[model samples]
Target chain A: MLDLALKSIMRSKTRSFLTTFGIVIGITAIVALGSVSEGLRIQISEALEMAAGLIYVYEESDQPLFLAMASSSLSEEKIQEIEDVGGIKESARFVMDIAYLDGDQQFGQPDLFINGVDPENEELLVTESAELDDGETLEGGDAYSATIGYSLAQDLDIGVGDTIELKEENFVIVGVYKKIGDPGLDNGVLIPIETALDLLDTEEYSGIIVYPEDLDDVEEITDYINENIEGVTALSTEDVAITISSVIDQIQIFTFGIAGISAIVGGLGVLNTMIMSIMERKREIGIMKAVGATNNCILQQILTESVIITFFGGLAGVILGSLGAYSLRFISSALESATVTPSLAIGSLIFAVLLGLLGGFYPAWKASKLDPIEAIRYE
Target chain B: MSKTIIEVKDVKKVYNQGKPNELVVLKDIDMKVNREEMIGVFGPSGSGKSTLLHIIGCLDRPTSGKVYIEGKDVSGLTDDELALIRGQKIGFVFQQFNLIGSLTALENVEMPMRICNVEKRKAIKRAKKLLSSVGLGERINHLPSQLSGGEMQRVSLARALANEPDIILADEPTGNLDSKTGKEIINLMEELNKKGFTFVIITHDPLIAKCASRKLNIKDGKIWR
Candidate 1:
């Protein structure tokens, strides 16, 4: 029976290939989209862990539509009150602005972020992950010294003792931080808060980072700052992580919905192919019945043919999806932050086979129930 | 005084029963074939000879009355049980040379044995021997489409003999063959009959009927021997 099924599928090579191609497309969509979303989720969680036990106090309007344009800074009195919060261990006021790198056109129109942070408080809050590869970190009241990130140093082809111009003022790079894999920090240069205010002509800070005395105090400190500090919203790192995860999950659901539709269409393709095959092989089935083949044999043959087609289709889809994920560099360079790793789980292979079986069942049952006398005369 | 291999008693078949245009194909057909006997059923088109062959082979059930094979009444058997009997005790050759077109000659011949769950090596050996005996040894690998009408019928004959069945029910076995090839097939059946294989051949040709040990004429759904 298996031999007969194989021969029958081989007999109609074009039809079999077209049917399998549908499954291939469906499985490819599932695997590729699944990997991208999974990679995004992993990267977001990792970023959150790097900034763990810290809270961010940003000024923004309640309306989501205007949140991007709402950039009110905290007043000095509000900052003092937040510093006096019970569970707050340390607090840092930071200003951020985009600055062009001096004579670095390696990346077309190179733009680097300049962050102004108080050296004493910045060092206390900067996670242990941010290590200096060479030279000392910026000291308090250092007006001419700046610390460069690993990628920024590489972009300008400079290290410690090198000077770079920002806003027509030269500053020496006293330290180069090791790679942290965070895009914002990796491409930024850090300098003193006073120098940043002098260059940007602003005295107010953009945001503040607060660290709690203990990990368990993070939530209490965030609550305290939100209740006491006016015109500011305090968010724990975990809350930010959750918000990002939920957004990613929504995207994943939408992507999988599309993939599911494709898979269903693929199953219909298999069903169509099986029905046509049965129609063509009516006389042949009659011959088998007359030669002592039971109805079960006929059913098994049809199902086996469908499964073989889809199994191979699934295998091809896995290989193709993996190749697509690995070539993310061509798809989008932004995906570099998230490592796209395609997974060929055993569950997915089983899903492919189940799809074939579902599509093949009704047609096979119809074939099995055909009247031998009529079938033999069916031409 | 041989034992009876097939006995049909008062068997009748009706199609589309109780409908506006009901038709009875077979009525009050009583027949018996002893072991090793070559019985020919002759009739014109629409004479229900094929329907009788189907009932005798257990491929279809009678609307009323009983069919007995090897002295056991099979009219009440389920479809699966009838299929088992067909696989074990009976083989059928069709007028159209109904060999599965996708399979080779050897594969067609091996089909019945495989249905009986014969092991791969054993089925292959027997299939080769059957094809060789039917003069299809060199053509074992040729598909039905590649074979001539006579060669295809020979392959079908080899398939019929695969299970070493007690009764070979051949429905117009040479109906699609040329006169010469038809005569050759009749000779082959006669040879097999001489080797103690019983045959119930349905044909419209008097020349083919004359080859049988006993002939029964079917007309208007009744058997007239």
Candidate 2:
């Protein structure tokens, strides 16, 4: 029976090919859209990982969106109170200075979002593997030491051991860090928090870095700071993660919703193709049933054909979509900065297969229940 | 006394029971066939020969009355049960030959046996024997389109025998053949009948009726004496 069904399909090569193509298109569209959404999620995840150690403390009553846009400073006394919390391995408070560095001289000052950091705690938050084009990391008591991103270094034409004059203060670059894909790491300069404070000429800190002895104590210390610290909001790594995650989630939801439309259109294409195939093969189906093929047998043949076409198209689409996303990431690395991962490929392929199944149902059912006499007579 | 292989008890088939267009195609059709008895039903067009055959073959339901094949009542059987019985106990050869165009002559013959769950090796062996018996041993691998009308009918005959059916239902099996070829097919069927294969053939040709062990003349939806 299976052989007969296969032979029938082979007999109508043009029709079968056309039907398979419909499934292919559906699978491809579904996979491609899913990959885009998955790629966006990974980009956001990496961005959050880059900012893992930096806590963005805000007023407990502050609206999340408002907190995101608001720029506020923490007092030195509040920083000390946060430092006193148990599990706070260290703390540093500093203000941001928007200073541009052109090797050994100042460039037009760019609007840079900078955080004052204690030399000890700065290294903890800065990705340790972060390489620089020039200069060394700031150590407490090292006068005018700084590190810059590879992109920033390239823009300034500076390399390791080069001098960068920021806010009229000349500092020798000890270590130049290779740029991370995240926006925070790619186009910024990291100077000693005290130097940033001196440059801004303020004792107030832009934000504080609170290092926990263990990741589990992050929330506990954050809560303690929230209750005891004044004029400052306390946030842990998790709070920052949740904040960014929620925002990314909203973006992901919106994009995924848009992508879903294309996926559905693709699914409908598959359904339309399968329906036509069923219509064309009505006589063939009757012939099969006449020859003792059960409904289940017919159903299996149709489903197998559908799944096979879907699988092939889905796999191809995933590969193509990943390449597309990767190409986009490669082009934007210099500008926005990020890597597209392979998880998107796997995830989209799965969704494409599911969509294919959804698309295959009605037509397969129609084909299965056709009466032999009527079907055999169908043109 | 030969074994009674099939019995139809006053079966009536009415189309569109509740509609103004209600039509009666078969009215109280009574039929019985003994093993090895070759019967011919002669009728003009619309005499309901095909409807009677379909009811007897369990491919259709009657408006009223019962059909028995091999002594089992088939009227109340579910679709699956009817299908299983058809696959196991009956073979059909239609006026159009109805060979699956995609299958080779051997494969077409092997179809009924395969449907009966015969193993591939055994089905092929039986198909080969049947094809050879029909004098088409050399054309086993030729598809239906490659065969002449006579050859196609011979393959259909082979298929009708593939399941070792108790009876063959041939609906104008020779209608598409030339006169000479038609004679040859009737001779072949007669020879098979003599070998203890029962047959119920529906035909319009009087000459064909002359070849049967019994002749049934049908008119206006009922068998007439």
| lDDT of every predicted structure (CA atoms) | 0.82, 0.71
Residue-by-residue lDDT tens digits, candidate 2, A1-379: 5575567556667865665555455445444454454555565566557656555554344556434324566676666666667776655554554544343435433434344567765655465445544445666337577766666676668776777766677777666677565444455667777677777788766665666777677777777777677656776555665776787678667755766666667667668777877887787677666656666667777776666556666776666655555565455443232223456556666776777688878888788777777787776
Interface RMSD of each: 1.0, 2.0
lDDT per residue (tens digit) for residues A283-357 in model 1? 888777877778888888899999988888887877676666667746653455433353433444566788899
RMSD for each model, in Å, please? 4.2, 4.5
Which segments of model 2 are wrong by more than 4 Å? Answer: A1-26, A29-33, A36-70, A94-116, A127-136, A140-144, A149-159, A162-171, A178-182, A198-204, A213-216, A334-347, B102-143, B194-196
TM-score of each: 0.84, 0.84
> After TM-score superposition, what is the CA distance of residue A228 in candidate 2 from its true location, in Å?
3.9
State the fnat of candidate 2 relative to the true structure.
0.24
| Interface root-mean-square deviation, candidate 1 | 1.0
